[model samples]
Target: MTDIDLNQILTFVKVVDSGSFTKAAEQLKQPKSRISRRLAALEKALGTQLIYRTTRQMQLTETGKDYYQRCAPLIQDLENANNAMTSHSVELSGVLRLTAPEDYAKMILAPLLEEFLKKHPKIKIELVLSGAYLDLVKESIDVAIRIGTLKDASMKSKRLSSISSIVVASPGFLEKNPAITKPEHLEQVPCLNFNVGQKNRWRLVKDKQDIRIKANGSVEANSPELLYHFALYGRGASLIPEFLCRDALQSGKLVHILKGWTSGAIPVHLLTPAQKDIPAKTKAFMEFASARL
Candidate 1:
């Protein structure tokens, strides 16, 4: 009935997801007593017991389960529509929080973000650069730039670009090492490990042949960026992103090796938390980065 409050229904869903009113209060920054009152009121309005409760744990009744499934998506659709309308009328002016890889944050996003911010002077940006995975919803991140495949199908993602990696060494390292005529020659040459991946192994595919090398070197580093510097210093051959190492490869600072081979292209995505409607800034930035990347 119209007397059944929509906010109570939303709070009910959150309570179910958070497992208890106590946890839901913490997540929503609301009072547990208030949540209990609302839930009781919603049940009274519906004239049915929606949940089976004890001091220890709670379970959803058949009516509650059915009601939740039906109302949750309807609430989301309503929220999305409301957000879309509200955001369209206002100029974007707020903080936009984002997380991305260190290499990308420095080499790629930095410049693009500068231009984007200039165009929207009222907007502010907070960026976190790391290789570690973060919870977008828990951390309240506006957007994230993730490499390779995505795991969360619930969150909205936009494919920006494909990042392909290449194996390269400094001109000096190659000159000092063997002729490197084939992929097998890499074993003779020192191959620095990138981020301890695959434990001294390099996977390359070419000619429909899958080549897995027991690759090792004098140095193991945490980032491809670090290994890039090591390779520049003529330490060892390393695999680095092709787009990132473009300048170094062009100026002969780094020379491409193992012709007709690659570690393969990884799909990069712009990710945002699952929302009925995405925020204005997040949508704008995703479009901006997609156009440039």
Candidate 2:
């Protein structure tokens, strides 16, 4: 109807999507009172109550539900049109918040971020590193680089690459231990376990044959970097991502075991929140990382 009405409808859509006025305000970068007033004004202008508010929860009324269903797609289409028009002309500038595993951030993302920042001097980055999966909306994360199978169907994902695991141990440990000639030999030796809720089972494939073994290990950790270090110090053999221990393998500090048998490959993905319009800086970083990593 009016320009102010259009703005209020956008706010209403955001509140519905976010499930609360407080969260919607945070996302829209506005005060909670302002968001409340806008919604109230919208109701007065339209002569219909859209939402039933409570201290603990919010629910859309019958009218609100129908209105929201109609408005959401129209709003999304408008945003897409706006982004398409301004994308090429606008120089991307903003804080792009990202999250990833601690070890991967240190080893892989550090250099890429540096390069990306150099290219776009106006953009700033905030990186959160953790072993556990963080909720993108809850944490306000713009992008995430994750390794393994994705469980959250709500988030959008782009597969970057598949990382292969290598079973490795130090030269000294191998000298003292029994020869690990076949996949079965792994069960006899002390193996470093990457604990991720599963049992200490290592699956290897060789020449169309699949073998699974329950690896016995004295040290078990959730972090791959720790496992790599333990293997380097001659503590035990470990299954780790090839990129993490590439330098050690090259320097002869760690030796690749079970040469013919291969550990399975884990899929790496670039994750983003399921939203209609992605921020330019976040999209730019995703593109940059997808090409390089």
Candidate 3:
């Protein structure tokens, strides 16, 4: 019956995403009343109810859910196209949300962000350092630096680095514990574990032969940084990425064991949403990280 406006659609999406008119208003930098009025206008213009209000929480009606499922992609596409087209001249501005494991964040990403921010002075960044696999679409992440094989088949990825796992232990631990002459010797000493495939297994490869060992340890955690610390403290030997332990291995904090064998090269990736054109901020960060990593 009437033409729907982009502002109304954006406002509705913001409200749904933020979970309340008050919160959405804060994100939009608009008054709560203005946000409510826009959402009300959208419903009136459509001639149907889109949401049910309970005075505390907002729930989308069936129509609203269906509408959001369709409109969100369209809205994202519009913004992405505009960003891609204008990015040539517009000095990248806006908050870039990123996620990565804590070890990478501390050892690699933090410094990169520092240099990137200096060059792109107008851009802001939000970094989430975690080992959890977060949904890019649901979490509104701009891009993520992830290790290992990419799981989300829909997301586009760029290879940032190829890192091989190195077996290591503290010098003190090696002195006190039995010498590791072969892969199976790892079972006798505690093995600080990293989460892989719901089990603790290190598959070492050398000269086309593979040795599989079920890692046993007192300290097992998802974070490579934590495991590195554990090894540094002589808690156990751990199979960690060479990139993560290279500095320590050289500085004598951690000793590399089984030097001839490796856990193979694992590809690190930069992931972005597959549905949209690469926005300037995300593209710039990815490029900066790719070259540096």
Candidate 4:
């Protein structure tokens, strides 16, 4: 029996996972020719054709499927062991991919990331900011910061903090429009609606009493940051995160309205994929963010 090359096996697994040699080569930081050569060498050593490749697509053979099913887990275990071993002896260094809401990333995470990077200079970060919940495995995201209820039970989550929502308007807008003395008064004024998850309605709570008001407005947007700006410009009253409006409220640029009523506290969570072993870099960021956020 010929002594098999572990590198060839690793290359084979990479090719299968990536679905093409070109992609696998790019990920491995090797030439396409080298990836092909490795796959050919691996097949020769095994005495079987593992992959059926063409111009458009690549498919695994019967033996290849069985081999991959067995090999993938073993490869993961080896990589995990290597990561675990190296993490203790050396500084954490790897590209950590993270995703979060755009506004939150800019206002909250930007500074924290700067600090995190300063602490771990060797680590590189790839941030994907979007309002949509991206699939972790498909997007290859290492960690995600999310606000509100988590629907996916498959992912592991760590509760960071609870963010309370504030209903606010600018001093100028309040002077020109109807004064909001209670929750019912909100309907009479122009409300800057944040159209995400929920309808054009604002939910307010005060001491066990829950009130739902149908919000009518001239401006509606999916971004809370935009709404915050609109509120500052005295466009309309906006229901936004308190953190986003705290400075404006203090400076008197924005006035907190319906003081006793709140939109309720939304839970913030750090999410990671469900796996046997979490990479040290991902774990480090999660812990770092958990304490600070």
For this target, which candidate reaches the highest TM-score against the unseen true structure?
2
State, as a TM-score between 0 and 1, how close model 2 is to the true structure: 0.73
- Model 3, 1-293: lDDT tens digits are 35777889999888887788998999899999998888889999998888999877889999999988888888778777677677767788899999998888887788999999999999998988877789988999999888888888888998987888889999999999999989999989899998756288889998888989988988878777788889999999998878789889789999999988898878889999995357788888887888898
- Give candidate 1's error at residue 179 in angstroms: 0.9
lDDT values for all models = 0.86, 0.89, 0.86, 0.91
Deviating ranges (above 4 Å) for candidate 2: 1-85
- How far residue 17's Cα lies from its native spot in candidate 4, in Å, is 21
- Could you estimate the TM-score for every candidate? 0.71, 0.73, 0.69, 0.71
Tens digit per residue, CA lDDT, model 2, 108-145? 88999999999888888899998678999999999988
> Native-vs-model 3 lDDT?
0.86
Better of 3 and 4 by lDDT: 4
Kindly give the stretch of ten consecutive residues in candidate 3 with the minimal lDDT sum.
Answer: 79-88
Show where candidate 3 strays beyond 4 Å.
1-86
**Which ten residues in a row are the worst by lDDT in model 1?**
79-88
lDDT of 1 by residue, 1-293 (tens): 78988789888988887789999888778899999998999999999988898999999999999988998888778877777676667778899999999998898899999999997778999998877779988988999999877888988889988887888999999878888878888888788897544588888888788788877789897788988999999999988888778999889899998877888778999988887557787877887899989
Task: List CA RMSD, all candidates.
Answer: 5.9, 6.6, 9.0, 8.0
> Model 2: how far is 92 from its true place, Å?
2.2
**Per-residue lDDT of model 4, residues 87-203, tens digit only:** 767898989999999988988999999999999999999999987889999999999998889989999999998888889999999999987998899888899999985588889
Find the 10 residues in a row with the least total lDDT in model 4.
1-10
